[model samples]
Target: MNGLIGKKIGMTSIFDAAGRNVACTVVELGPCVVTQVKTEETDGYQALQIGFGEAKEKNTTQAQIGHFDKANTTPKKRVIEFRDFNAVEKAAGDTITVDEVFAEGDTINAIGLSKGKGFQGVVKRHGFAGVNDATHGQHNRQRAPGSIGAASYPARVFKGMRMAGRDGGRRVKVKNLKVIKVFAEKNLLLVRGAIPGHKGAYVILEK
Candidate 1:
């Protein structure tokens, strides 16, 4: 259940050994440092906390500095906990590269926040079909919900009714995405198909 935190470097098409055009999402992955190790006896769990992305030393607080000192690594912008230590046998200040986490054809789940679309209607958000009349006395209610409730039965609008409202901007997990390739030298991971979130957003890659 080990995972790595990385930034989405957008996506591109690349050819495999067979010369097939493979759709992929390029990610700038690890080189994340092992910050803290939780043990079974003390923390009641076995896990290693890794830090990624460097933050300016001037902006980092004293408490953060002390924490990084324990691992002998410079201040990081973000820190994520990964369960299980035996996966990499990582130590404090040790960098975890993409090669150590995933390989080609490895099945993984990419978790990230989807891009916000800002107040979308049900037709676009939840895929609800709208009124099919473009004419025939129809004016501007084409995108409106035709009916909401029963007349003399329920007498109230039912809960969980799909309506036009705020949309997107939520954590989405794309499961079973195959890892097409791994560029360890550039810390890049090319995954097949589209993933959630906008470019440069932080994404969690889990296997």
Candidate 2:
């Protein structure tokens, strides 16, 4: 699969040729530099490791700076590798622009870390139904998971129980999304429907 590294640049609605409104996510696509190329003879597989975004000189470590030097590019904020890329001929220090890989109405997939929701309850996270009474004897069982396990059979809470703790901040992939528009000059990619993570968050666009 061919992929590009981009930033989620919020969302907006636009009118299509059919005069219908379409919701789209605006992404700042890449002019990613191919930093390293892994060949089967050497690294055991063929892959293109690319780098994107700009990082401050002092913020990145010396080792990362040196890796960017191999590509003759500036310090990048993040580095990602794409396996078995054959969409376009690429090389080390070569720039892969977003326009070459994506087109309007093309089906693509997006991967990103979801926004953190802190600690969540079972009702919100696991979709459990709480107690349903206020007048009987229950005082506050609105958002509770009543019984976890049986008394004699199990004796203790079973493993893999649907209990809520920390939620979100996990990698999520949104698939089969249609590319609404591509602004090649601006390196902007607009896609239909909602994507993972928050605005300005780093996202991987795969086709």
Per TM-score, the best of the predicted structures is 2
TM-score of 2: 0.93
lDDT per residue (tens digit) for residues 147-170 in model 1: 888998879988898888899999
Candidate with maximal lDDT: 2
**lDDT per residue (tens digit) for residues 4-102 in model 2:** 999999999999889999899999999898999899999999998988899998999999889889888889987899999887888789999988899
> What is the RMSD of candidate 1?
2.0
**What TM-score fits each model?**
0.90, 0.93
How far does residue 63 in candidate 1 sit from its true spot (Å)?
3.2
